[model samples]
Target: MLMGLLWASAAAAEAPSMPGHPEGPMAISSRSMTVKNLDHRIIFDRDVVVKKGDMDLQADRVEVILTAPPNEAAGHALSALPGAGGAMLAEDNVERIEANGRVKVVQGGKTATADQAVYHNADETIVLTGRPETWEDGYRIQGSRITILLKEQRSVVEESRVVIYPDEGSASGGP
Candidate 1:
């Protein structure tokens, strides 16, 4: 009787697991995923596979990397958990999160995209390359390179120039 009960308990514990909560801390797949960032309100819908410590998350597309005010202070110092504040979803055609496509970022009516992008949550910055374009607060800026500096709350464009695209004429009246 005791032996029978032990076997049943073991079998029950062997049930399938869920994403981000797998048995070991890792998940893998050939599909796409969507990831979202709560803090920034940023969403990434593309092919992506991510690993956090011992856990693995994979999908054809992913949407994530949203940001919000830190519960404590502005620019408060703390180490961040890898792939902690987002969700990954699966879909058809393994979505590539890193390269060879357009990446869109939306913040406060501003939209920006680039061929490639890297989001560093620890530094609170995003780097976009390859003909990056940005539309923010009725201003549009395009350049060969763009660096979003969240620390100072500004976007810096390198090469070419920064142009403002507004519904009306350029609001700053600079040209």
Candidate 2:
């Protein structure tokens, strides 16, 4: 009886953990799912789809990487589940993010698609490449090679041929 009770308690304690769900976002793969925890309250899922107000983020895998401002008060310090650290969220400190397989991020009428993507919390940006494409604000950009310039809030494409889809009533250049 004691053994059974102990097992039950352990299960209960781990129920909300990222591994426990495996059904959450961190481990989702169209069949299985996992949730990556960030600061306890903030959790992101792998192979997940998220909608935030006017933005949408979708990916095959996800992670949480955040850093508390040193100047911030201790009470505001955020902590993640024990043993659930070290997952790189981005090129730097990232927090509760998703990636894997194919990643797509849409924000403020801009859409970006890539084979891999990483969201950075410290700089509030996402870096994606592997044939990335970005469309937004009256312009559409695509390239066999691309980089999302989060800091400049623009996309830089390399070795890419750009074709601006002409609108109606626009005259074609004379031959």
Candidate 3:
């Protein structure tokens, strides 16, 4: 079952307007895919990988939920290219995404891993659960849950354990 509710506020645009998602063309690949038009979603399973600009998400299962119906998505999906053998799910029409089982997301030098992740496109945030972990700037954080504010470059961890690593070249193993 999906865990997020994205409001119908995604503007139908000729291109995806999501910031940091370069020109808004997302590429996806998976071992298997299922299209549920009535549900307005595309499901990918088994080694699913989705790439948009510099960001990448990989999981055992992933779902792309659309703001509009399939027909509307087709009309707007020019912003989203076909992901390998999967259906043409448009990037512009994407409202939210849910990833499950061995989910990993990478953007620039930051990396996150979780058993489950939900991407809130409009909110520009990602919430992760099931042993979530984040690594960046030589520091690592792990927790039962994590919330990342993409635009603000901030993260909140619950039941968190943090580890700060020393600089590799520093004397005395300290910065």
Candidate 4:
């Protein structure tokens, strides 16, 4: 029963959305799962993959932490038994997610690879660490850490190196 609830919650996690990508439902699969209701945490281990629309996330393990609604206390009856209240309880409670061990994320024409990635729901930001690299539109950025602000459609690479490719039609020499 606990497993069933955990699966349902994971399935209901909102799909991440980028500027041009469609917002679809997230689908996640893994070899094993564990749910800690008391701690409001869920873990997916061993070849975890999450997909939604044009985005895909792959990692060895993924952890989800749910946040209590404002004015609501933690470990409430509704939260403890997420399945009891149907999809609403499961979907909106997610606070943050962490993907660890060879984390890779692809969205639209962009791809990001890292040893770990964390997504914060409240701020709509994703932070990648451990030799993070991102490639998009013939450009690539590599750094120790990468922060993507989904709401603002901005990315910041720290301790970074960048490569940009000129357009095919652009003049190579001064014209």
Each prediction's Cα lDDT score? Answer: 0.37, 0.39, 0.63, 0.58
Residue 44 accuracy (lDDT) in model 2? 43
Model 1, residue 146: distance off in Å is 0.8
Query: Candidate 1 or 4, higher lDDT?
Result: 4
Give per-residue CA lDDT, model 2, range 1-175, as digits (tens): 0000000011221112110101111211222333323343233444455444345566765544345331232433332232432111111233434365577765443456777666544444444567666543333445565543343434445555443444622212211
Q: Write the per-residue lDDT of candidate 1 for residues 1-175, one digit (tens) a residue.
A: 0000000000121212111111222122223332222342223344544443332332333333223322222342122334643332221112222322544543223345566665454454456687766544434556676655444444556664444444534432321
TM-score of 2: 0.49
In candidate 3, how many Å is residue 157 off? 1.2
Q: Each prediction's TM-score against the native? A: 0.41, 0.49, 0.74, 0.70
Best first by TM-score, ranked: 3, 4, 2, 1
Query: Model 3 Cα displacement at 43 (Å)?
Result: 0.4
In model 4, where do residues sit more than 4 Å from their true spots? 1-21, 68-91, 166-175
Query: Candidate 3, residues 56-169: lDDT per residue as tens digits?
Result: 778999988888765676575523344454554565587888899998776655567789999887877778899887655555667787765555544566677766567622
Q: Among these predicted structures, which one has the highest TM-score?
A: 3
